[model samples]
Target: MADLYRRTVLVTRPEPGLSDTGFALERLGWEPCLAPMLRIYSVPMKQAGAVDRVIVTSGQSLEALRVALPPATPLTAVGARTAERARTLGFTAVDYAEGTANSLVGHLGRAGGRNSVLLATGRKLGVDLAAQLRMNGWRVTRRVVYRTEATESLAPAARSLLEQERVAAVLFYSAATARAFLDAFGEERGLLGSVRALALSPTIGRTLGAAPFREIAIAPRPEQQALLALLGPLPTSDTNTARREIAP
Candidate 1:
């Protein structure tokens, strides 16, 4: 049986997302240590030009470009969550794939419109999507709508829990976040040997780079629900009776 008392899972995504994930973890009876590995800063769009469609891979990109682009512009997102976010932001037409940039490329290819697409993404990111779209004969304009900078260290609470071997798992949402976490704490592989690394995707799991974790599990799908499912159900107990009622 898993350790019900030591259900601490380090959340390594950036904020806004960090809070949401933390809340979800708490509802599932896991104690979440909010440790952001990257900081996101919105970059103003200098020239978006007119485009028939917009592509957004992350909520951060959608937030950055929601006002810059027309709400009614046909928008394609990389996942359902991002697509829903686009809709909430007043986008009239939004489409999404099954939570991956590669899947998004396939979705666009099947849709078969070679129209110009404005891709709102973070700086130095989305190279593969842009290249793939161009190869498919679509006019692609890439715009850096956000910048993500790696943090120097993990949060004090997370570091303390890790040092004490109190953390049962670590949740990594992006390859960049995984890299940042490794860069900050790679020397402490011994400390992590008993900790599980739960990655949202295979790419992020690979970024963990042979870290001696108790286990490294990748989500069946590149989404939050699937990633959390890797943790399994919390042990049933009087302490978590309330949590169980609210858990999905």
Candidate 2:
């Protein structure tokens, strides 16, 4: 733990939520380098029809949907954090998926009675969840409540720190951020080679691929607590061979 002191960890999430990650890192005595890899901006979309259930892939898309949809509308989220946020927003029927939108789609199919759903999502999506549900005969009202453009550059401070080879670890919350980070820093393979990547899920790790980091450790869960758990000393290999998440 002596080596963990003040070690810089690059946090790549959009603003507002970026602050949350910063605070969490600060609590752990880790220096957080803020270099948002995606710009989350709200888009004015219409109020969804009799929204039987609301599907939220990203927490940033919640605000727009809350305003557009009714208060008591049931909500389903891709992660625990999003589900918790939805519950706090006066939503009673809040459920969460352990994984991505694809996981949520399967969860919904078995949950039953979620006939009509307003999928409050960002413009950019890794999986076409709406289309998947539509093919299965579910009424999916796909609402792009937020526009996410992949960030192509980092802040000068973050860039300088990376160039200096000072970034010890990187925290990736989403697949989009993984792509964006590589987009901006793929050329600096030398800088990236020594850094450890802590990804929120398997998909995020796979998206990052094996080229960038010395080692990639994936959290057991997709929640913040799970991601933060990897802040300590990492093992040489994972014991869970059946679910080999870590990539070398």
Candidate 3:
């Protein structure tokens, strides 16, 4: 634990997304390096009337849905936080999916009533969930609620810390952000040798394939709490490396 306090972590998610992890890292005694890999912009979107259901794959999708989606419309959220946000925004019927696009697809498939619906997402998005829904016979409308752009480069502080090997861990929340982070540092793989890459899911860990990380740890579940829990153990501990806390 003392060794953890002496190192910093690179936070690569967008602004609000980075804040919660930042606070969590601070409480755990690790300095946070705020280097947002993605910048999210809520697009001006306004729709009227109600639909059969709504599918939100990310929290940022709510940027437009909060106004466009009626209070009574049923919603399928891809993550726990996204479900909670939907309910808070007045959606009464909310179905929660584990943090994966496939899981969300399964929920709609089982529901068997995923007919015509709005698929809220970012301008620059990952996982062609909308296309998948269409293939599954659901009439999906692509709604670009927000825009996510990659940061041109890492912040000076973040770059300095990374180059100095001062950061102990780098938390990755999504493959898109991971790709953006990788792009920012393009080919400077050795600089990351001292850092552990903590990924929120196996898909994310796979997205970082062959990166020059000292080690990679995938969380038991694709949730924020699960991701943070992986950091609770000592950095040198390998018993839990590459293993999900739950049986796969």
lDDT of each: 0.82, 0.75, 0.76
Evaluate model 3: give its TM-score.
Answer: 0.83
User: Which portions of model 2 show Cα errors greater than 4 Å?
Assistant: 1-6, 90-92, 110-114, 135-137, 233-248
Please say which candidate is ahead in lDDT: 2 or 3. 3
Worst 10 residues of 3 by lDDT: 239-248
Cα deviation in Å at residue 176, candidate 2?
1.2
Question: How well does each candidate superpose onto the true structure, as a TM-score?
Answer: 0.91, 0.83, 0.83
lDDT of 3 by residue, 36-140 (tens): 788888886656345678788888887677776567788889988889877887889998889889988887783356477777877756348877887788877
lDDT of 1 by residue, 34-141 (tens): 778888999988796778899988888977787687788999999988888789889999989999989989898833554889988999999988999889878889
Q: Give the CA lDDT, 0 to 100, for residue 158 in model 2.
A: 75
